[model samples]
Structures are given as C-alpha cells and as structure tokens.
Target: MTSKPPLLASMFAPWPRIPIDTTDGSDFFHLDRVAGSAATGWALGPEGAYEQNLTLAEVVDGAVREALLHLLELGLIDIDSDRLNAAPGLPTHRERAVP
Candidate 1:
C-alpha cells in the first residue's frame, strides 16, 4: 500500500507538549473571560482554564494560534496546506505562491 505523505502524516502525530504545573494546571496561555475588558484584543487573566499567564488580544485568534502550535508539533498540518490552503488553520487566508 502507498504510504501517506509526510505533510499529511502529521494528522496522526502526537499531541503537542503542554506545560503542566504540579497542580495539573497549564503554565502557558491563560484562558480568561476577557470579554469584560474594552480592549480591542482579548486579554487573559489569572486562574485560566488552560494556562495561567498567556494574554492574547483576540480570544479567537489566541485559540487558533495555540491549536496550530499543538498540531504543528505532531505534524498534523500538511505542508501543502500551509502553502496552498488560503486559510492554513489560521483565522486569515495564507495563499501559497502560484508557481
């Protein structure tokens, strides 16, 4: 049987490394209810569901970035996806070169 491409191989890659504290909590990005803040970008607060101090401008943007980071670790994202897909798992469109 033909093997899958390396790019597509990431789909089965292991989960990204997450920093967990002794309390079994995250130590990276902090998920907070930034909706309260008037700041155009979302902000993370203490005691977040995820990490504890990662403050992002847009909550959606932050979530995506974090997810991509994890997927990249396991090679889940296809190389072509990044180059071909207008939206490479990101909020914006990342078009590849025509050639």
Candidate 2:
C-alpha cells in the first residue's frame, strides 16, 4: 500500500496562545491568558488547545521566535488541510525535530 504526504492539520490545530490585543493596549500580552504560562513559559498555541504567555511585547515576540525556530529546525512545513499526513518510510515530522 502507498502512503500519503503528511498534512499540517493532523499535527496541529488553531488555538490562542498570548492574550495580547493591540487595540486594547491595556491588557497587553498578559501571561495569565496562557493556560500553562506559569509552568512552561510558553502558550497553548495551535499544537494544543483548551487542554492548555509572555510579557505584553517581549513575551509575544519571544513566543513567535520560539515557534519559528521549532518549524525551521523541525522541518514543519505548513499545509492547507486540517489533517496531518506523513510520507511513507519516514518518521513523523514533529518527532524528528528537537528543541
């Protein structure tokens, strides 16, 4: 049987991470919004959901940088679909990449 190329959705889903609102400005990027902000120093982004940030500006910036690094080093290419598919005879994209 032949396999398929992994789709981006399966591996990740859309979720809120930082609680920052440029319009509000007052709230800024409150870490409290993040589910596990106190523990992980990260936010509950697409990779995770309700099951889950940084400062107003610094925190948000840092989070984005970190996420980008993960994608680059891990080779996590974005896909348009909602299902995460993988190439045959290869390890899962997320698993292969490391922090």
Candidate 3:
C-alpha cells in the first residue's frame, strides 16, 4: 500500500535558503460563501460552508488563530474533507506572522 501524500505538509517544505521573518501574529479571518447563490448569498455544497482564500491566512493573529480553532472545532473547516485547496507558496504578509 502507498502512503497518502502530505497535502498541508507541502507548506512546511524545506526552504532554509528562504529567509523567515519573525513577528507577532494578527487577528483576521475573513470568510466568504462557497458556490452559494448566484445573486443572494448563502451556504451550499456537500454540507454548507464557505471556502476561504489562502491569502486570508496571512493575518495569522493570535486571536485569528483562536477563531480558526473555533471554526475547526465547529466543523466550518473540514480537516478531513480536503476542501479549501490552494497553491503552494507564501502569501503576502504571511511571513510577517511567521516565527
């Protein structure tokens, strides 16, 4: 049997050469509807939830991280559904929250 590839693990890939910035986290977790209504806004899809953009993670504020945890516990973000896909790369301001 073959092991499943590391999906989220890709973000932590080796990049020592890439400088890492050290700073405090932020508190910002903007949410939007997934393929909801065409005109009006509403949750849709497998169950019901919005798909967040990777760019939003840039503001990794302590409070935001807390909210994220809350959402995760509430099943807003599927830790198993494999949703919220994004390109492999650092987004603007993301490094600022690093370290």
For 77-99, candidate 3 gives per-residue lDDT tens digits of: 54544323552543333334333
- TM-scores, all candidates, are 0.28, 0.26, 0.26
Order the candidates by lDDT, highest first.
Answer: 2, 1, 3
Clashing residue pairs, backbone N/CA/C < 3 A, model 2: 6-85, 6-86, 7-85, 10-83, 10-84, 29-56, 31-53, 55-59
Candidate 3, which segments miss by more than 4 Å at Cα? 1-60, 79-86, 94-99
Question: In model 2, which runs have C-alpha deviations exceeding 4 angstroms?
Answer: 1-54, 78-99
5-72 per-residue lDDT for model 1 (tens digits): 33222334432332333232432212222222212222243333244454444455665555555555
The TM-score leader among the candidates is: 1
- Model 2 lDDT at residue 40: 36
> How many clashing pairs per prediction, in order?
6, 8, 4
Instruction: Give the alpha carbon lDDT tens digit for every residue of 43-71 in model 2.
Output: 45442322322345665555655655554
Of 1 and 2, the candidate ahead on TM-score is 1
lDDT-better candidate, 1 vs 3: 1
